[model samples]
Target: MSTLQSQSKIEEANKELVRSFTRTVFVDHRPDRAVEFFDPKGKWHGGNFGTVEGAQNIAGLLTAVVGGLPDIRATEQDIIVKDDTVVVRLVVEGTHKGNLLGFPATNRRVRWDAIDMYKIKNGKIMDDWASEDGVKILADIGAYTPPWMKSGN
Candidate 1:
Protein backbone atom coordinates (compact mmCIF):
# COMPACT_ATOMS: atom_id res chain seq x y z
CA MET A 1 0.00 0.00 0.00
CA SER A 2 1.08 3.61 -0.55
CA THR A 3 2.16 5.77 2.38
CA LEU A 4 -1.01 7.87 2.13
CA GLN A 5 -3.26 4.81 2.27
CA SER A 6 -1.35 3.41 5.26
CA GLN A 7 -1.68 6.71 7.12
CA SER A 8 -5.38 6.86 6.40
CA LYS A 9 -5.82 3.35 7.73
CA ILE A 10 -4.01 4.31 10.90
CA GLU A 11 -6.27 7.32 11.40
CA GLU A 12 -9.33 5.15 10.83
CA ALA A 13 -8.12 2.68 13.45
CA ASN A 14 -7.55 5.49 15.90
CA LYS A 15 -11.03 6.81 15.34
CA GLU A 16 -12.51 3.37 15.93
CA LEU A 17 -10.52 3.01 19.11
CA VAL A 18 -11.80 6.33 20.41
CA ARG A 19 -15.38 5.47 19.45
CA SER A 20 -15.18 2.16 21.29
CA PHE A 21 -13.69 3.80 24.34
CA THR A 22 -16.37 6.50 24.42
CA ARG A 23 -19.14 3.94 24.03
CA THR A 24 -17.77 1.68 26.73
CA VAL A 25 -17.05 4.35 29.31
CA PHE A 26 -19.87 6.83 28.81
CA VAL A 27 -22.69 5.28 26.79
CA ASP A 28 -22.26 1.81 28.24
CA HIS A 29 -21.52 3.16 31.77
CA ARG A 30 -18.46 0.99 32.16
CA PRO A 31 -15.80 3.17 33.74
CA ASP A 32 -13.94 0.12 34.93
CA ARG A 33 -13.03 -0.67 31.35
CA ALA A 34 -11.45 2.72 30.75
CA VAL A 35 -7.98 1.69 31.78
CA GLU A 36 -7.91 -0.86 29.01
CA PHE A 37 -7.95 1.86 26.40
CA PHE A 38 -5.46 4.20 28.06
CA ASP A 39 -1.72 4.07 28.18
CA PRO A 40 -0.10 3.41 31.56
CA LYS A 41 0.99 7.04 31.74
CA GLY A 42 -1.94 8.56 29.96
CA LYS A 43 -2.96 12.06 30.99
CA TRP A 44 -6.34 13.75 30.94
CA HIS A 45 -6.60 17.53 30.81
CA GLY A 46 -10.07 18.29 32.06
CA GLY A 47 -10.78 21.94 31.60
CA ASN A 48 -11.81 23.66 34.86
CA PHE A 49 -11.52 20.35 36.70
CA GLY A 50 -7.76 20.37 36.19
CA THR A 51 -5.53 17.57 35.01
CA VAL A 52 -5.47 13.89 35.94
CA GLU A 53 -2.45 11.77 35.14
CA GLY A 54 -2.04 8.01 34.85
CA ALA A 55 -4.54 5.52 33.48
CA GLN A 56 -5.79 4.60 36.94
CA ASN A 57 -6.33 8.24 37.91
CA ILE A 58 -8.30 8.91 34.73
CA ALA A 59 -10.43 5.84 35.36
CA GLY A 60 -11.01 6.99 38.91
CA LEU A 61 -12.31 10.31 37.68
CA LEU A 62 -14.76 8.52 35.40
CA THR A 63 -15.83 6.34 38.30
CA ALA A 64 -16.63 9.38 40.40
CA VAL A 65 -18.66 10.90 37.58
CA VAL A 66 -20.57 7.68 37.09
CA GLY A 67 -21.21 7.50 40.78
CA GLY A 68 -22.85 10.90 40.71
CA LEU A 69 -24.80 10.23 37.52
CA PRO A 70 -25.58 6.57 37.50
CA ASP A 71 -27.64 6.83 34.33
CA ILE A 72 -25.22 9.04 32.47
CA ARG A 73 -24.85 8.52 28.73
CA ALA A 74 -23.17 10.40 25.92
CA THR A 75 -24.41 10.72 22.35
CA GLU A 76 -21.75 11.56 19.82
CA GLN A 77 -22.83 14.40 17.57
CA ASP A 78 -19.62 14.79 15.61
CA ILE A 79 -16.32 13.00 15.23
CA ILE A 80 -13.12 14.05 13.47
CA VAL A 81 -10.01 11.99 12.98
CA LYS A 82 -6.62 13.34 11.90
CA ASP A 83 -3.34 11.53 12.20
CA ASP A 84 -3.12 10.25 15.80
CA THR A 85 -5.83 12.48 17.18
CA VAL A 86 -9.58 12.10 17.43
CA VAL A 87 -12.04 14.82 18.41
CA VAL A 88 -15.60 14.10 19.44
CA ARG A 89 -18.49 16.41 20.19
CA LEU A 90 -21.09 14.85 22.45
CA VAL A 91 -24.24 15.63 24.28
CA VAL A 92 -24.25 14.06 27.72
CA GLU A 93 -27.43 13.37 29.61
CA GLY A 94 -27.94 12.02 33.10
CA THR A 95 -29.83 12.18 36.35
CA HIS A 96 -28.25 13.35 39.55
CA LYS A 97 -28.58 10.39 41.90
CA GLY A 98 -25.58 10.93 44.15
CA ASN A 99 -23.29 13.67 45.40
CA LEU A 100 -21.01 15.40 42.90
CA LEU A 101 -18.47 18.14 43.40
CA GLY A 102 -19.62 18.49 47.01
CA PHE A 103 -23.20 19.11 45.91
CA PRO A 104 -25.89 16.86 47.31
CA ALA A 105 -28.09 14.84 45.05
CA THR A 106 -30.79 16.87 43.32
CA ASN A 107 -32.46 13.97 41.47
CA ARG A 108 -32.71 16.31 38.51
CA ARG A 109 -32.05 15.41 34.93
CA VAL A 110 -29.12 17.24 33.38
CA ARG A 111 -27.93 17.59 29.84
CA TRP A 112 -24.75 19.25 28.64
CA ASP A 113 -22.54 19.28 25.59
CA ALA A 114 -18.85 18.54 25.53
CA ILE A 115 -15.91 18.28 23.18
CA ASP A 116 -13.09 15.83 23.80
CA MET A 117 -9.85 15.37 21.92
CA TYR A 118 -7.71 12.29 22.27
CA LYS A 119 -4.21 11.45 21.13
CA ILE A 120 -3.61 7.81 20.31
CA LYS A 121 -0.32 5.98 20.51
CA ASN A 122 0.17 2.30 19.88
CA GLY A 123 -3.60 1.77 19.85
CA LYS A 124 -4.00 3.34 23.31
CA ILE A 125 -4.96 6.82 24.39
CA MET A 126 -1.88 8.76 25.41
CA ASP A 127 -3.52 12.08 26.14
CA ASP A 128 -6.99 13.58 26.30
CA TRP A 129 -8.27 17.15 26.49
CA ALA A 130 -11.86 17.48 27.61
CA SER A 131 -14.12 20.53 27.62
CA GLU A 132 -17.60 20.38 29.10
CA ASP A 133 -20.38 22.85 29.76
CA GLY A 134 -19.94 23.08 33.50
CA VAL A 135 -22.12 26.11 34.01
CA LYS A 136 -25.06 24.46 32.28
CA ILE A 137 -24.64 21.33 34.31
CA LEU A 138 -24.51 23.31 37.55
CA ALA A 139 -27.59 25.24 36.57
CA ASP A 140 -29.49 22.10 35.55
CA ILE A 141 -28.65 20.48 38.87
CA GLY A 142 -29.84 23.56 40.80
CA ALA A 143 -26.36 24.05 42.11
CA TYR A 144 -25.83 27.49 40.63
CA THR A 145 -27.87 30.60 41.23
CA PRO A 146 -27.88 33.04 38.37
CA PRO A 147 -27.35 36.73 39.01
CA TRP A 148 -30.99 37.49 38.24
CA MET A 149 -32.06 34.98 40.88
CA LYS A 150 -30.15 36.73 43.66
CA SER A 151 -32.30 38.44 46.26
CA GLY A 152 -30.35 41.72 46.09
CA ASN A 153 -31.06 41.98 42.40
Candidate 2:
Protein backbone atom coordinates (compact mmCIF):
# COMPACT_ATOMS: atom_id res chain seq x y z
CA MET A 1 0.00 0.00 0.00
CA SER A 2 1.07 3.58 -0.62
CA THR A 3 2.02 5.87 2.26
CA LEU A 4 -1.15 7.89 1.85
CA GLN A 5 -3.29 4.79 1.91
CA SER A 6 -1.56 3.51 4.98
CA GLN A 7 -2.12 6.82 6.70
CA SER A 8 -5.76 6.83 5.77
CA LYS A 9 -6.27 3.37 7.15
CA ILE A 10 -4.63 4.36 10.39
CA GLU A 11 -6.78 7.46 10.61
CA GLU A 12 -9.93 5.49 10.04
CA ALA A 13 -9.00 2.98 12.69
CA ASN A 14 -8.17 5.77 15.08
CA LYS A 15 -11.53 7.40 14.44
CA GLU A 16 -13.32 4.16 15.12
CA LEU A 17 -11.40 3.74 18.32
CA VAL A 18 -12.41 7.20 19.43
CA ARG A 19 -16.01 6.53 18.59
CA SER A 20 -15.97 3.28 20.49
CA PHE A 21 -14.54 4.93 23.55
CA THR A 22 -16.95 7.83 23.46
CA ARG A 23 -20.06 5.81 22.88
CA THR A 24 -19.37 2.49 24.51
CA VAL A 25 -16.67 3.10 27.08
CA PHE A 26 -17.36 6.59 28.35
CA VAL A 27 -21.11 6.45 28.15
CA ASP A 28 -21.26 3.03 29.67
CA HIS A 29 -18.37 3.60 32.10
CA ARG A 30 -16.75 0.44 30.94
CA PRO A 31 -13.12 1.20 31.48
CA ASP A 32 -12.15 -2.40 31.88
CA ARG A 33 -13.58 -3.10 28.47
CA ALA A 34 -11.38 -0.57 26.69
CA VAL A 35 -8.52 -2.92 25.99
CA GLU A 36 -9.47 -2.95 22.33
CA PHE A 37 -8.82 0.75 21.91
CA PHE A 38 -5.33 0.89 23.36
CA ASP A 39 -2.12 -1.03 23.04
CA PRO A 40 -1.18 -3.17 26.01
CA LYS A 41 1.91 -1.06 26.53
CA GLY A 42 0.38 2.22 25.47
CA LYS A 43 0.95 5.48 27.29
CA TRP A 44 -1.29 8.51 27.85
CA HIS A 45 0.37 11.88 28.28
CA GLY A 46 -0.62 15.44 29.21
CA GLY A 47 -3.62 14.75 31.38
CA ASN A 48 -2.63 17.45 33.93
CA PHE A 49 -2.63 15.18 36.99
CA GLY A 50 0.03 12.92 35.52
CA THR A 51 1.10 10.70 32.68
CA VAL A 52 -0.24 7.17 32.63
CA GLU A 53 1.66 4.32 31.03
CA GLY A 54 0.26 0.88 30.48
CA ALA A 55 -3.31 -0.10 29.75
CA GLN A 56 -4.05 -1.06 33.32
CA ASN A 57 -3.11 2.32 34.68
CA ILE A 58 -5.06 4.14 32.01
CA ALA A 59 -8.03 1.92 32.62
CA GLY A 60 -7.96 2.64 36.31
CA LEU A 61 -7.84 6.36 35.70
CA LEU A 62 -10.73 6.16 33.28
CA THR A 63 -12.81 4.21 35.73
CA ALA A 64 -12.29 6.73 38.46
CA VAL A 65 -12.91 9.73 36.26
CA VAL A 66 -15.93 8.44 34.41
CA GLY A 67 -17.62 7.39 37.60
CA GLY A 68 -18.82 10.92 38.15
CA LEU A 69 -19.95 12.00 34.71
CA PRO A 70 -23.64 11.54 34.13
CA ASP A 71 -23.26 12.39 30.48
CA ILE A 72 -20.22 12.84 28.30
CA ARG A 73 -19.56 13.53 24.67
CA ALA A 74 -16.36 13.77 22.73
CA THR A 75 -16.86 15.51 19.41
CA GLU A 76 -14.12 15.66 16.86
CA GLN A 77 -13.55 19.01 15.27
CA ASP A 78 -10.91 17.86 12.82
CA ILE A 79 -8.67 14.91 12.11
CA ILE A 80 -5.36 14.86 10.28
CA VAL A 81 -3.61 11.73 9.22
CA LYS A 82 0.08 11.49 8.56
CA ASP A 83 2.54 8.65 8.34
CA ASP A 84 2.08 6.42 11.39
CA THR A 85 0.12 9.11 13.24
CA VAL A 86 -3.30 10.68 13.53
CA VAL A 87 -4.01 14.01 15.18
CA VAL A 88 -7.48 14.91 16.33
CA ARG A 89 -8.96 18.16 17.53
CA LEU A 90 -11.90 17.54 19.80
CA VAL A 91 -14.33 19.10 22.22
CA VAL A 92 -15.25 17.14 25.35
CA GLU A 93 -18.59 18.06 26.86
CA GLY A 94 -19.69 16.51 30.12
CA THR A 95 -21.77 17.10 33.19
CA HIS A 96 -20.17 16.70 36.60
CA LYS A 97 -22.23 14.61 38.97
CA GLY A 98 -19.54 13.53 41.40
CA ASN A 99 -16.38 14.85 42.99
CA LEU A 100 -13.38 15.40 40.72
CA LEU A 101 -9.86 16.62 41.38
CA GLY A 102 -10.90 17.92 44.83
CA PHE A 103 -14.00 19.71 43.57
CA PRO A 104 -17.43 18.52 44.55
CA ALA A 105 -20.15 17.98 42.00
CA THR A 106 -21.66 21.19 40.78
CA ASN A 107 -23.81 19.40 38.20
CA ARG A 108 -22.24 21.87 35.79
CA ARG A 109 -21.91 21.17 32.13
CA VAL A 110 -18.24 21.28 31.27
CA ARG A 111 -16.96 21.88 27.80
CA TRP A 112 -13.30 21.48 27.04
CA ASP A 113 -11.55 21.74 23.70
CA ALA A 114 -8.76 19.23 23.36
CA ILE A 115 -6.14 18.09 20.92
CA ASP A 116 -5.08 14.46 20.84
CA MET A 117 -2.23 13.00 18.84
CA TYR A 118 -2.08 9.27 18.42
CA LYS A 119 0.80 7.15 17.22
CA ILE A 120 -0.11 3.97 15.46
CA LYS A 121 1.99 0.91 14.78
CA ASN A 122 0.88 -2.22 13.03
CA GLY A 123 -2.65 -0.76 12.82
CA LYS A 124 -3.02 -0.36 16.57
CA ILE A 125 -2.72 2.77 18.62
CA MET A 126 0.66 2.69 20.37
CA ASP A 127 0.51 5.89 22.31
CA ASP A 128 -1.17 9.26 22.63
CA TRP A 129 -0.51 12.85 23.65
CA ALA A 130 -3.43 14.99 24.69
CA SER A 131 -3.98 18.59 25.75
CA GLU A 132 -7.32 19.90 26.95
CA ASP A 133 -8.73 23.25 27.98
CA GLY A 134 -8.67 22.44 31.67
CA VAL A 135 -8.64 26.07 32.63
CA LYS A 136 -11.80 26.78 30.76
CA ILE A 137 -13.62 23.91 32.42
CA LEU A 138 -12.54 25.06 35.85
CA ALA A 139 -13.40 28.68 35.17
CA ASP A 140 -16.79 27.77 33.84
CA ILE A 141 -17.51 26.00 37.12
CA GLY A 142 -16.11 28.92 39.13
CA ALA A 143 -13.30 26.79 40.46
CA TYR A 144 -10.66 28.87 38.79
CA THR A 145 -9.88 32.55 38.97
CA PRO A 146 -7.90 33.72 36.01
CA PRO A 147 -5.21 36.29 36.71
CA TRP A 148 -6.12 38.31 33.66
CA MET A 149 -9.74 38.55 34.76
CA LYS A 150 -8.88 41.24 37.30
CA SER A 151 -10.48 43.77 34.96
CA GLY A 152 -13.46 41.40 34.62
CA ASN A 153 -13.37 40.81 30.89
Candidate 3:
Protein backbone atom coordinates (compact mmCIF):
# COMPACT_ATOMS: atom_id res chain seq x y z
CA MET A 1 0.00 0.00 0.00
CA SER A 2 1.09 3.58 -0.64
CA THR A 3 1.91 5.95 2.23
CA LEU A 4 -1.31 7.91 1.69
CA GLN A 5 -3.43 4.75 1.76
CA SER A 6 -1.73 3.59 4.96
CA GLN A 7 -2.36 6.93 6.62
CA SER A 8 -6.05 6.86 5.71
CA LYS A 9 -6.37 3.36 7.06
CA ILE A 10 -4.82 4.41 10.36
CA GLU A 11 -7.21 7.33 10.67
CA GLU A 12 -10.20 5.10 10.06
CA ALA A 13 -9.01 2.65 12.67
CA ASN A 14 -8.60 5.43 15.19
CA LYS A 15 -12.11 6.66 14.52
CA GLU A 16 -13.55 3.19 14.98
CA LEU A 17 -11.61 2.79 18.20
CA VAL A 18 -13.15 5.98 19.56
CA ARG A 19 -16.61 4.90 18.46
CA SER A 20 -16.20 1.56 20.20
CA PHE A 21 -14.96 3.19 23.37
CA THR A 22 -17.88 5.61 23.45
CA ARG A 23 -20.34 2.78 22.90
CA THR A 24 -18.85 0.65 25.64
CA VAL A 25 -18.45 3.33 28.29
CA PHE A 26 -21.04 6.06 27.79
CA VAL A 27 -23.82 4.58 25.65
CA ASP A 28 -23.62 1.23 27.39
CA HIS A 29 -23.23 2.84 30.85
CA ARG A 30 -20.23 0.69 31.56
CA PRO A 31 -17.64 2.96 33.12
CA ASP A 32 -15.87 -0.13 34.40
CA ARG A 33 -14.91 -0.92 30.86
CA ALA A 34 -12.95 2.30 30.49
CA VAL A 35 -9.72 0.54 31.30
CA GLU A 36 -10.10 -1.48 28.16
CA PHE A 37 -9.84 1.64 26.01
CA PHE A 38 -7.83 4.13 28.03
CA ASP A 39 -4.13 3.99 28.50
CA PRO A 40 -2.89 3.25 32.02
CA LYS A 41 -1.94 6.90 32.50
CA GLY A 42 -4.54 8.45 30.28
CA LYS A 43 -5.49 12.01 31.09
CA TRP A 44 -8.88 13.66 30.80
CA HIS A 45 -9.14 17.44 30.57
CA GLY A 46 -12.64 18.17 31.80
CA GLY A 47 -13.41 21.86 31.62
CA ASN A 48 -14.27 23.30 35.06
CA PHE A 49 -13.97 19.81 36.56
CA GLY A 50 -10.18 20.07 36.38
CA THR A 51 -7.80 17.63 34.82
CA VAL A 52 -8.22 13.99 35.79
CA GLU A 53 -5.17 11.77 35.45
CA GLY A 54 -5.01 8.01 35.09
CA ALA A 55 -7.58 5.68 33.63
CA GLN A 56 -9.05 4.86 37.05
CA ASN A 57 -9.68 8.51 37.84
CA ILE A 58 -11.31 9.02 34.46
CA ALA A 59 -13.50 6.02 35.13
CA GLY A 60 -14.42 7.48 38.50
CA LEU A 61 -15.63 10.63 36.79
CA LEU A 62 -17.67 8.58 34.35
CA THR A 63 -19.13 6.64 37.26
CA ALA A 64 -20.31 9.85 38.87
CA VAL A 65 -21.98 10.99 35.64
CA VAL A 66 -23.72 7.63 35.26
CA GLY A 67 -24.75 7.70 38.88
CA GLY A 68 -26.43 11.06 38.39
CA LEU A 69 -27.98 10.19 35.04
CA PRO A 70 -28.57 6.49 35.01
CA ASP A 71 -30.33 6.58 31.69
CA ILE A 72 -27.96 8.94 29.97
CA ARG A 73 -27.42 8.32 26.25
CA ALA A 74 -24.88 10.01 24.01
CA THR A 75 -25.68 10.38 20.34
CA GLU A 76 -22.91 11.39 18.03
CA GLN A 77 -23.80 14.42 15.99
CA ASP A 78 -20.49 14.60 14.16
CA ILE A 79 -17.15 12.86 14.13
CA ILE A 80 -13.83 14.02 12.62
CA VAL A 81 -10.73 11.94 12.57
CA LYS A 82 -7.21 12.65 11.38
CA ASP A 83 -4.18 10.56 12.11
CA ASP A 84 -4.18 9.88 15.88
CA THR A 85 -6.90 12.31 16.85
CA VAL A 86 -10.67 11.95 16.89
CA VAL A 87 -13.15 14.70 17.67
CA VAL A 88 -16.80 13.96 18.34
CA ARG A 89 -19.75 16.26 18.72
CA LEU A 90 -22.40 14.57 20.82
CA VAL A 91 -25.93 15.23 21.93
CA VAL A 92 -26.37 13.84 25.43
CA GLU A 93 -29.77 13.18 26.96
CA GLY A 94 -30.61 11.93 30.41
CA THR A 95 -32.79 12.22 33.49
CA HIS A 96 -31.50 13.76 36.65
CA LYS A 97 -32.07 10.82 38.97
CA GLY A 98 -29.22 11.39 41.41
CA ASN A 99 -26.94 14.15 42.60
CA LEU A 100 -24.90 15.82 39.87
CA LEU A 101 -22.39 18.63 40.23
CA GLY A 102 -23.58 19.00 43.83
CA PHE A 103 -27.18 19.50 42.76
CA PRO A 104 -29.67 17.13 44.34
CA ALA A 105 -31.86 14.89 42.26
CA THR A 106 -34.46 16.83 40.26
CA ASN A 107 -35.90 13.89 38.30
CA ARG A 108 -36.01 16.16 35.26
CA ARG A 109 -35.01 15.19 31.77
CA VAL A 110 -32.14 17.16 30.24
CA ARG A 111 -30.51 17.32 26.87
CA TRP A 112 -27.22 19.02 26.11
CA ASP A 113 -24.45 19.08 23.57
CA ALA A 114 -20.82 18.22 24.10
CA ILE A 115 -17.64 18.01 22.07
CA ASP A 116 -14.78 15.71 22.96
CA MET A 117 -11.40 15.31 21.33
CA TYR A 118 -9.30 12.24 21.92
CA LYS A 119 -5.71 11.39 21.13
CA ILE A 120 -5.10 7.75 20.40
CA LYS A 121 -1.82 5.91 20.81
CA ASN A 122 -1.30 2.25 20.20
CA GLY A 123 -5.09 1.74 19.87
CA LYS A 124 -5.72 3.26 23.32
CA ILE A 125 -6.88 6.72 24.28
CA MET A 126 -3.96 8.63 25.73
CA ASP A 127 -5.66 11.98 26.28
CA ASP A 128 -9.12 13.50 26.03
CA TRP A 129 -10.41 17.05 26.19
CA ALA A 130 -14.13 17.43 26.83
CA SER A 131 -16.43 20.45 26.72
CA GLU A 132 -20.12 20.29 27.65
CA ASP A 133 -23.02 22.69 27.83
CA GLY A 134 -23.17 23.06 31.58
CA VAL A 135 -25.49 26.06 31.71
CA LYS A 136 -28.16 24.39 29.62
CA ILE A 137 -27.93 21.21 31.60
CA LEU A 138 -28.29 23.05 34.89
CA ALA A 139 -31.20 25.07 33.60
CA ASP A 140 -32.99 21.99 32.33
CA ILE A 141 -32.64 20.29 35.70
CA GLY A 142 -33.92 23.37 37.58
CA ALA A 143 -30.52 23.86 39.15
CA TYR A 144 -30.01 27.27 37.59
CA THR A 145 -32.45 30.17 37.25
CA PRO A 146 -31.76 32.40 34.32
CA PRO A 147 -31.68 36.16 34.75
CA TRP A 148 -34.78 36.50 32.62
CA MET A 149 -36.59 33.96 34.80
CA LYS A 150 -35.78 35.78 38.02
CA SER A 151 -38.63 37.61 39.74
CA GLY A 152 -38.64 41.37 40.26
CA ASN A 153 -36.76 41.92 37.03
Candidate topping lDDT: 1
Off by over 4 Å in 3: 148-153
lDDT of 2 by residue, 1-153 (tens): 997787677678767666666566656667777666778898888778578888787777777667656576677788876666778888877888877666889888888898988887765567888887878878766699789764757
Which candidate leads the pack in TM-score? 1
- Over 1-153, each residue of candidate 3 has an lDDT whose tens digit, in order, gives 999999999999999988998898778999878888899999999888789999998898888888899999999999999889999999999999998988889999989999999999999999999998888888999989889878999
RMSD, candidate 2, Å: 2.5
Off by over 4 Å in 1: 148-153
Whichever of 1 and 2 has more lDDT, that candidate is: 1
Candidates in order, TM-scores: namely: 0.94, 0.82, 0.93
Which candidate do you rate higher for TM-score, 2 or 3? 3
Collision count of model 1: 0
Candidate 2 ranges beyond 4 A from true positions: 1-11, 27-29, 150-153
**CA lDDT scores, all candidates in order:** 0.93, 0.75, 0.91
- Show the colliding residue pairs in model 1: none
